[model samples]
Structures are given as C-alpha cells and as structure tokens.
Target: MENDFEGRPSSEEAAASLRDLGADRQALADGVQVPKMLLAALGGVAAWWVAGAAGANPGENYEPPTSGWLGLVAALVIAHLIRRETGIRFRKMGPRAALVMAAIPVLCLILFSISLGLGSFGARWAVLLTSLSAFGLVTWLAGIAFRSALDQLRR
Candidate 1:
C-alpha cells in the first residue's frame, strides 16, 4: 500500500525551494539594509560637534559658525552615501579601509589646526574652509577606491 505522505514534500524541502526562489545567497548570508535612523542621528551629532568646535575661538579672525556646520554635514552625507552604495557593512570593510577612512578625518582636523595656527583670519572660518576642502577631496577619492575594491572583491 502507498503511504499518505508519498506525494508530499517534506517541510525542509519546501522551505529550501522557497529560499532558492525568493532569496539570493548574499541576502541569506548577510542581511543588509539602509541604516536611516543611525545615519540621521550621526548627522545631528556632527552638527552639534561642529557648532561647539566653532564656538571655541581658536584665536583667528574668520569666525563662521555655518561653515563648520556645512563641513560636518558634507562628511556625514558622504559616509551615508558610501554605506548605501556598498552592501559591505562598515565593520566588514576590513581594518585597512577603516584606517584610511579614519585618517581622512584626522587629516582634515590637522589641516584645520594648521590653518588656525596661521592666524590670518578667524580661526573658525579658516578651520571650516580647510576641513570642508580636505573632506570633500577625501570623499571623492574614497568613492573611487571603494568602487575599485568592490570590483576586485567580485572577482
């Protein structure tokens, strides 16, 4: 006699079929999604930090609070865009990329400090312009680097 379950697939088999049809290997391996709230909160914190940095009066003449805010916003936007374009999580980008990304901000900070040392203009304005230009350049370079790295990884 034939068993009642002879024609029926096991639950595991059905689940495997659904997974094959609906999900990619990568999706199953490492789930990824836009971290919107985290990004927004990071932007807000950067804005607040820039405001405080601007207020510190580093003994220069070009005191512009908005400049600091703009630079901070630009960096945050760049980081957010990078995260969106790459499925690679920030933590998973490896120490090398993390080191490079970290260095970009530190270099910007160093430039700002040097600009302030020049003492030709308001410290705030000098720092803001220096930071914005440096960060912008670094962000552009980083986009290229990330694309290249992703290409290499795909192979």
Candidate 2:
C-alpha cells in the first residue's frame, strides 16, 4: 500500500500537472534585476529625505504634508514597479504578504499623526526623525519581502 501510494504521486504533483506549468525560476530572477532594486531604494530614500526636511522646517508647514503624501505615493509606485518588473503580480501575493505591506504605511501614518497631535515644539525634530525612520523601515521591509518572495518563486 505504501509503495502504491508513493508511486501514485502526491497532491503537489497532481496540482503541478493540472496547472500545465513549469517553473521559470531564472526568468523571474532576471526580470527583477539589481538595478531595479537599487532604483527603488533610491526613490524611497529621496522621498523620506524630502518628507523629513519639510517636516523639520516650521517655516514651510505645507511643505512637510505635501512631501509626506508624495513620499507615500512614491513608495507605493516603486513597490508596484518592482512587482511588475519581477513578474510578481500583486494579485499573486498571499494574504500574509499583503497584510505586511499594507500595515507598514498605515502604522507609520498613524504614528506621525499621533506625534503631531502631542504638540511639543521641542519635539519637531524628533517627530521628523520618527516619521522618516518609519518610512525607511517600511520601505526596507517591503523590499526584503519582495526579494524573499521572488526567491521562493524561483525555487
């Protein structure tokens, strides 16, 4: 019975056969190159810097809010571009993966808003740093997740 079961092919094999597919590990890796990753990172950094600078300067209150929004937009765009270039569709993302990516920005925004509401002049620099750091952390985490997912897909 064990031998018969062994020879019959597992569920994974059955699924694989049903899909009529073969892995394109190398193609996937090639699609998402180092340069693209670097560009994404650079874009994230630029966004964070702009936000921090604007947030820190009281003279330009409008600047910080604008930059913060721009930064968030840029991060999402970069993430989508990375997904496209890597042949990783957003729809392909598992529920856990989607939650991780979505939570990052939402948490960061919440933190920033809470900090602003506290209202301490001396805390301006701290607020700026915190916000930028959150942005950077979230971006970095997303990048890592993307790469890891790609690696898995390659396998």
Candidate 3:
C-alpha cells in the first residue's frame, strides 16, 4: 500500500535540506565584500572634517567650521554608495560592529577638538597630525566594523 506521507520529505531529507541551507548562507556570507575605495573615501572625509578646524577662527570671531556640514553630506553620499555596492543591508551588525561604528564619530570629534585647540594656539601645522590621525583611525575602525559585520553573517 502507498504511504499517507509519500509526498512529504523524510527526517533525513529534512536534515540534509537544512544543512544545504546553512552552507548556502555561509557561501553568501563569504561572498559579501566591502569595497576598499569606499572605505578610503570615508577616511578622507573624516580627515577633511577634522582638518577644517585649521582654517576655523576660534573664540572672538569664531566662524563655525562649515566644512563639517560639507563633510556630513559627503559622508552620507559615500555611505549610500557603499550600500549600493555591497547590496547587503544588514539589519543588525552585532554589538561589536555597532560599537566600532559608534566609535568612529567619537574619535573624529576628539581629533577635531584637538585640531581646534591647536589652531587656536596658532599651531596650524599641528592640524596635519590631527587630520592624519582622523584618516588612520577612521579607516582602521571602518575596516574593523566591516569585518565584524561579516562575522555576524557567518553566524
């Protein structure tokens, strides 16, 4: 006689299917890669924002650094480009990635503040150090965050 569940998958078949699905997820995760150029652009923008403090007039005639606004816009554009290039919009990048992402701005702000202080003291040349710091730190952190995101996908 024919079995009532003839059309249904057996337990072993179900397990195999699940294993294939897991392997597919792993393959997709491995295939996803962030573009290096975008990360460099992000670093450049971060450096520019911090470097803006060099030309800023602090104290008495403090003309607020307008480069900050421009930098924000540039950053947004770069982020859009990155998303478009990657095509993987992560809903949750895990806590490590989140922390690293959060740290980028904080680090930039610190560097900007330092630049402002140096500029105020007529140490305009020092802004270069801060700008370089911004570039290095931002680029490094961005890479870490991307790796963390990839790690999340592996799970």
Give the TM-score (vs. native) of candidate 3.
Answer: 0.90
Question: Candidate 2 at 82: error in angstroms?
Answer: 1.8
Clashes of 1: 6
Clashing pairs in 1: 60-122, 60-123, 61-121, 61-122, 62-121, 62-122
Per residue, candidate 2 scores C-alpha lDDT tens digits across 73-112 of 7766776666566555634555555666667666666665
RMSD of each: 9.1, 8.1, 4.0
lDDT of each: 0.52, 0.56, 0.89
Taking all chains together, the TM-score of candidate 2 against the true structure is: 0.54
TM-score of each: 0.41, 0.54, 0.90
Clash tally, candidates in order:
6, 0, 0
Segments of candidate 1 deviating more than 4 angstroms? 1-57, 60-66, 83-91, 121-155
Q: What ranking emerges by lDDT with the best candidate at the front?
A: 3, 2, 1
Q: On residues 50-117, what C-alpha lDDT tens digit does candidate 3 reach at each position?
A: 98999888898788777888988998998889889999888778999999999999999999889999
lDDT of 1 by residue, 105-131 (tens): 566556555655644455565556554
Winning candidate number (TM-score) = 3
| Superior candidate under lDDT, 1 versus 3 | 3
Prediction 2 global C-alpha lDDT:
0.56
After superposition, the stretches of candidate 2 with alpha carbons farther than 4 Å from their true spots are: 1-64, 87-90, 117-121, 151-155
